[model samples]
Target: MTRILVTGGAGYIGSIATHMLLEAGYEVSVLDDLSTGHKDAIDTRARFVEGSILDSDALTAALSNCSAVMHFAGKSLVGESVEKPDLYMQVNVEGSTKLLDAMKVAGIKDIVFSSSAATYGQPGDAPISEQSPTKPTNPYGVTKLKVDELLASRAVTDGIAAVSLRYFNVAGALQTSDGWLAERHNPETHLIPNIFKATPSAPLQVFGTDWPTPDNTCIRDYVHVLDLIDGHISALSIMKPGTYQVLNLGSGSGYSVREVIDTASRVAGRVMPSVDVARRAGDPAVLVASIEKAKKVLNWSPKRDLNQIMQDVVSSGA
Candidate 1:
């Protein structure tokens, strides 16, 4: 069996990816620091190493028998990134460089990095492609884009094949109730989960309602977390040495915040209360992905809609 190391495999996306990889018959080892990741989210079927990407010795141990890596570790909150830019840079970029150095030492050649659509910042157009300018409005996106560039450079110099899966707003939960993967972030900021958490008294806040979108609210592409994991697996299966690719993993269709609120209310069979607030700094009015590159390169497309995503979230008991 091919063994692969998944950094942050104890986090929401990483844990899901690890479980799916194990199901697909790959030997799996998880490396995580438990900073933002939950220990219980890890699958018992795989080897688990409690470590961070910044720790060389621990990373080496985790990568011992691994042939490849799927990195999902990092601080991901855009608002937090803006508040703590130094922390974001230190962890996301500096720690990633350490991981790369360790990979070079371990002789691992392929990696599928969990990147974000935030790298595109506020695109002037809808349905951003891989070619879109990466003007990240926040530190988190800047760090991710830095890694993407680092990987590209290293691919040529170090023979490391890398694929960056630039994801849009990731929501929902595990497709199956395996009980090994779920979103459990402290102070949850995702739209759907927050919508579920909203009650008659404490309504969810909609940031930016005077955008150029149809509903005068910011529009975004929300791909199911499951579909994003599938893209990771697909990228891992076909990676070649000395190559680099960036694919946007998102639903091609765009939905406004108002639409999302309405849909969530419908899906949950209740009135999901929400209030419109002023636009957030560095927030794009409309940020959708053109999944044409993902379709062509990875032979992948998102299989779940917003309704299906909400249903999956509820089914997972999340």
Candidate 2:
């Protein structure tokens, strides 16, 4: 079995990726600090190294005997990134630089990164493609864009095989032999989870109701965690040495805040409470990915829709 190192394999998406990689007959090693991930979410079968990507020693230890890496460890909150730009730069940019440096030392040539659609920032009404302008508005998006640039440069200089899967709003969960690997973010900044968590006492805050969107709310494209991982695996299989590729992984469609609320209400058979508040500091008015590149390159498309995402989140009791 090919050994792959999964950074941040204890978080929502990383944990699911670890489980799926193991099930697909690959030897997996997970490196996570549990700073924002739960320890119990890790699969016991794979080796777990409790550490952060910022630590060079941890990166070396985790990269032992690994042929490739699936990079997912980073600080990823838009609001928080706006507050702490320097921290985002440190963890997302500097830490990734360390990972790339360590990969050079370990003779690892392949990497699949968990990039975000935030790199597109605020674009035109059309769905964002890999060729779109990457003028990120927030510090978080800026850091991701910087990493993508770094990977592109390294691909040419070091002959590193790199795939940066730029994801939109990812939702839903996966059930493994262990349990459901669901979104357990503290403060729950995501829309789908916050929608389910809404209540009358402390209603969910709907950020930016005055956007240019049709529904006057921020619009985002969401993909299931399962589908996202499938794209990653496909990327891993088709990596070409001395090449860097970036693909958008999303449903190729979008849903507004109100639309999601209405959908959740229908799915749950009750009104999900929410309140409209001021716009968030670094959020784009709309961010939907054009996954045509992903389809052509990875031969993959998302199978789940918004309703299914809502249903699955509900099923997971998130």
| RMSD list, candidates in order | 1.3, 1.4
TM-score of model 1 (CA atoms): 0.97
Q: Compared with the true structure, what per-residue lDDT tens digits does model 2 show for residues 1-318?
A: 799999999999999999999999999999999989999999998899999899999999999999999999999998899899999999999999999999999999999998888888888747899899888888899999999999999999999999999998899988776668899999688889988888999898999889988989988898988999999999998899999999999999988989999999999889999998999776677888899999999989998888898888888887
Candidate 2 wrong stretches, greater than 4 Å: 208-212
Clashes of each: 0, 0
lDDT of 2: 0.91
Tens-place lDDT per residue, model 1, 1-318, is 899899999898988888899889999999999998888888889899998788889989999889999988899988899899999999999988999999999888999998999888888767899998889878888999999999999999999999999999898787545553668888788887888888778888999877876789888899998888888889987798998889999999899889988987787778888887888776667888999999998989899999898787777665
Error (Å) of candidate 2 at residue 295 is 0.2
Model 2 clashing residue pairs (backbone): none
The Cα local distance difference test for each model comes to 0.88, 0.91
